[model samples]
Target: MVKTNAMRMLDKAKIEYTTREYEVDEQNLSGSHAADMMGADHGCVFKTLVLKGEKMGYLVCCIPVDGELDLKKVAKAAGDKKVEMIPMKDLQKITGYIRGGCSPIGMKKQFPTFIEESARSYSEIVVSGGLRGQQIALQPQSLIGFVKGRFASLMQD
Candidate 1:
């Protein structure tokens, strides 16, 4: 099995997860879109977002496939006065992954991760497996264990 950073961390943390790979569709830019194309439940699909904290540079945000991220809420969740989405050039430079492939786990640095509080509503959630065309389905708690992410209403309404 080819392991991405997320998978490697899953192993190191002894978290149980199932890997799922879907075809890469150039037309999709959201998790719900990807899930529908892959025939997976949209509720269980999660999207990874990379944000910049004004001058702080980089942070990771995880929210449900159906949810939209609220930059204001994320700033509050990060306890920062302001937050902004990282530019594509910077995202690729820092994370070593293309726009659609960023994962909160195993970035160039271990960033503080924030997840949508609603994610706990699901038993298992799927996140990018650290690369395009792959995802991992694991218990939300196990994910929290590995990333130690804080839960908050950081998604957009």
Candidate 2:
């Protein structure tokens, strides 16, 4: 398997992880679909979201594949009053990643990140491998710490 920026960083950090490969379907680019392709448990598969805050600039959140990001909650966690999703067209230019392939591990810049607290319940979780059709599975804490992210209540109520 070819190593992506995300996997390379994990190696440099000496963080142990395992990768899973799946076929990408452009029509169904959602993380839940990714998990289904990998035959992975949805609970352990996370999706990364990037949002812009009034004062905090850009921040990220990792929630379950089937979960929703609570904009208000994430903004509060990032010490911002409010937040909104970054437009799709700007994703690659801003983060050096396109949709369906962005990883929380390595971006154009390190933005404040948050993983839904529910991730803590699992010993390991799966996240994008920096490319569509690839996934990286590692301990939740390792992934969070590598990204300098916090675990918070980011899922929508």
Query: How do the predictions measure up, each by TM-score?
Result: 0.91, 0.98
lDDT (Cα atoms) of all candidates against the true structure: 0.82, 0.93
Off by over 4 Å in 2: none
- Candidate 1 lDDT, 10-96, residue by residue in tens: 888888999888778877766877788678878778888888897555788888888878999998888888998887788878877
* lDDT for 59 (candidate 1): 82
Backbone Cα, N, C clashes tallied per candidate: 1, 0
Q: Which pairs, if any, clash in model 2?
A: none
For model 2, residues 1-157, the per-residue Cα lDDT tens digits are 8799999999999999999999999999999999999999999999988899999999888999999888888888988998999999999998999899999988999999899999999999999999999999999999988998899998878
Query: What stretches of model 1 exceed 4 Å from their correct place?
Result: 55-57
Residue 131, model 2: Cα distance from true site in angstroms: 0.5
| RMSD of candidates 1 onward, in order | 1.6, 0.7
In model 1, the clashing pairs are: 68-156
